[model samples]
Target: MPKKLPEVILYTDGACRGNPGPGGWGALLIWNGKEKEIAGGNPQTTNNRMEMKAIIEGLKTLKRPCHVKIHSDSALIVNTFTKGWIDNWIKRGWKKSDKKPVENRDLWEEMLRAAQPHKLSWFKVKGHSDDELNNRVDALAVAESKKF
Candidate 1:
């Protein structure tokens, strides 16, 4: 019989004061009723990079392979992962359909690699809603961004 895997839930958010200015990432990781918060920032970065970083950090926290549910408010992040856009990029050698260079290919590729060891489901949640965890992550991201 297969070993029982831990059920993990993660809520992530990213923020940027300006489009290409101060940026931060936040995540809330929950397992077996316990929760852990993760956050970071960069002085010069984009919101999308922060979003990808949040997922990358959250996944890296896992000790071993397990089932993971990732929640995000960014449609670009959720759709790109769930709709297989990343795989398409990989197949096309990290180029988009238009054959243009993929922006943030580094972070996206790192996120993809970090995600490979687990069973992941990407879910989209409305931002600034009543979701407590999501709101918490938003706050964390904002706070981190302010530090820059």
Candidate 2:
């Protein structure tokens, strides 16, 4: 018989003062009603990189593979997996349909590696609106960015 996998929920967000300036990424991981928050920042990074970092960092924190449901305000991150863009990109040697190199291949590769051991579901949420957890993560990301 196989062991049951624990279910986990993750919420991630990122913030940057300038387009290519100081930035931070934050995430919240929940399991069995307990939640853990993690955040970090870079001296200089783009909003998209920070966004991907939040997800990658969150997944990396997991001790073992489990069923993970990831929620984020960034549509690009969510869509990259949900809409099968990652599959095509990997198939095309990390090139987009336009034959250009993928902008964040490094992080995208990390995202794939961090996620491969688990069952993943991606969800998009409205940012700075009514979602309480999303708002909390946004606050965390913004606060971390200010520290840099």
Candidate 3:
């Protein structure tokens, strides 16, 4: 058998009934033509946490380092990487520009750690748009959140 490529594609979405109410996260990971779906919910959490959790869970599933491209509708998630906010936050001891502590610091730390083993690229997609994978994940997240 031919060796599989070390390239993975991930689509993630999060949904919450209220800003700090029940929430859920969904992720779809594709590698070498294989698909894996992962999801979870929190009884009391923010949308941002669910968003971060989606990507974190996806990355955590990788057994080995790979080149990963993550697609997310959350600007907070996309810009954090594409705009180099993660690096700055780390350099500033997890503080934003105004020296205030970053929100979701715990989740951010876990996400950073989960992503460290992989070479990652972040992409921003229009939420609830025509993207099939993105839409599917969004629906999944909504359904999961409703369970709580």
Query: In candidate 3, residue 92 scores what lDDT?
Result: 96
Error of 1 at 10 (Å): 0.6
TM-score, model 3 to reference: 0.94
* CA lDDT scores, all candidates in order: 0.92, 0.94, 0.93
**Best-to-worst lDDT order:** 2, 3, 1
lDDT of 1 by residue, 1-148 (tens): 9987788999999999998999999999999889999999999999999988999999999999989999999999999988999889889998999999899988887988998889998899999999888999999999999999
Candidate topping lDDT: 2
What TM-scores do the predictions have?
A: 0.96, 0.97, 0.94
lDDT, model 2, position 66 = 90
Error of 3 at 2 (Å): 18
- What C-alpha root-mean-square deviation, in Å, does candidate 1 show against the real structure? 1.0
Task: Report the C-alpha lDDT of model 3 over 85-110, residue by residue, as the tens digit.
Answer: 98999999999999999999999999
lDDT of 2 by residue, 19-91 (tens): 9999998999999999999999998999999999999999999999899999999999898888999899889
- Compared with the true structure, the alpha-carbon lDDT of candidate 2 equals 0.94
Off by over 4 Å in 1: none
**10 residues in a row with least lDDT, candidate 1:** 2-11
Report how far off residue 41 is in candidate 1 (Å): 0.3
* Cα error of candidate 2 at position 92, Å: 1.1
